[model samples]
Target: MIIVIEPDSDVPIYEQICNQIMEGIARGQIKPGHSLPSVRVFASDLGVNMHTVNKSYHLLEKKGIITIVPKSGAVISSPQDFNESSFNRLKDEFKPLIAESLVVGMTHQQIQNLVTSIIEDFTKNQK
Candidate 1:
């Protein structure tokens, strides 16, 4: 997966890195057991601080999206590991934003349709 960082964005570099890694996993571009580049290597490649990459890795681990080993580096978690309870938890975690979407004139059907389209696009890209 390619991670493009927007230097002009208000988001922090570490956050941008973390978000991209998580997005890669969500989109299946990065699969379970996939080893990420080492912190120093990624930082060098991205021209960011080593600490920034390190922080992103730790954040991913905290969210159960990756496993960080002392020397083995960070690995993506299995998609199968995201069970029904995990999905429900993620749904609950994002409930406030979803409610806000609804409040802003986004119907449930519209959101569903949008999500369906997104999934379709993602799958098509995979091939």
Candidate 2:
């Protein structure tokens, strides 16, 4: 999976890295048990600071999307790690985005359709 970072974007670099990693998981370009490159290597490859990649990995760990092991590296979390708390977290994360979409005048059907299309895109590569 390739992640393109926009230096001029309002979003922080670490957040962009985290978002792309999560999106890669959704698209099946990444999966459970796969090891991510070390923070230093990843940062060097992306031409970003090592601290930025470290922050992204830690945030993903906090979100239960990946696990960091000493001397091993970060690995994607398995589906079994998902639980009710994760579900609530997802809902909480969506609340603000949903509100913004509604505030922007997106109709219910439009929102539903958009979400469905995104889901399809994410699932398309799955077995």
Candidate 3:
């Protein structure tokens, strides 16, 4: 997975990592049963503190997106873990942003087109 971190951003580094990991799962770039890099190894690779990666991994585990096994490492959870109620919850959470996007000159067609392209690209990359 490719992660781009903005140090100056208000979000914490751990959260940034967590968000990217979640996005990777959502896009199917990382499949269920796939193991993620060791926390220490991933932190070293990203030039971040091990605690940062650990925090992100723990967060994923709490969210049911991953499982943390001692000595075995982190593994992506099955897609069956995600439910329609969770998606509805996410949609309700994004309601304001969806309205804001509409007000910001993003037409419905334009938004649909963008999402379609994003999904297409994600699928292509997953292959």
Candidate 4:
């Protein structure tokens, strides 16, 4: 997956890297066990500091999204099984956004459609 970072954005470079990598995994552009480029090389290519890439990789690992292997670099992890706690966490995370949508006058169908479109983007490679 190609990572493009906006240097001028308020978001940190590491976060942008982390989010893009997560989206890549969600879209199946980077599959489980796929080895990511080494920190030094990735930093050079992105014109960012090596520490930035390292921070992003470590954050991904902390979130169970990737496994960093010594000498072999980082590898994407297989998706985790969803359970009750996961569902609750998701609901908690999305609650405010859904509430905000409602306050902004988005109908239930409109919100559903928006979510469906995002899910479709992630599942496009499933087929």
| Residue-pair clashes per candidate | 0, 0, 0, 0
By TM-score, who's the top model here?
A: 2
lDDT of 1 by residue, 17-91 (tens): 998887787677888899999999899999988998999989888778889888899988876666776688789
Candidate 4 per-residue C-alpha lDDT over 41-118 given as tens digits, one digit per residue, 9 for 90 to 100:
999999999999999999888777889999998998777644576578779989999999999999999999999999
- The models' CA-based lDDT, in order, is 0.85, 0.95, 0.87, 0.90
What candidate 4 gets wrong by more than 4 Å, as runs, is: 81-88
Give the worst 10-residue stretch by lDDT in candidate 2.
1-10
Can you write out model 3's per-residue Cα lDDT over 59-91, one digit (the tens) per residue?
889778899988999999897888887788789
What tens-digit string does per-residue lDDT give for candidate 2 at 20-44? Answer: 9999999999989999999999999
**Stretches of candidate 1 exceeding 4 Å from the true structure:** 83-85
- The model with the greater lDDT, 2 or 4, is 2
Predicted structure 3, TM vs. truth: 0.78
Q: Could you give me the TM-score of model 2 versus the true structure?
A: 0.93
**For every model shown, what is its TM-score relative to the native structure?**
0.85, 0.93, 0.78, 0.86
Question: Which residue pairs in candidate 2 collide?
Answer: none
lDDT, model 4: 0.90
Error of 4 at 31 (Å): 0.6
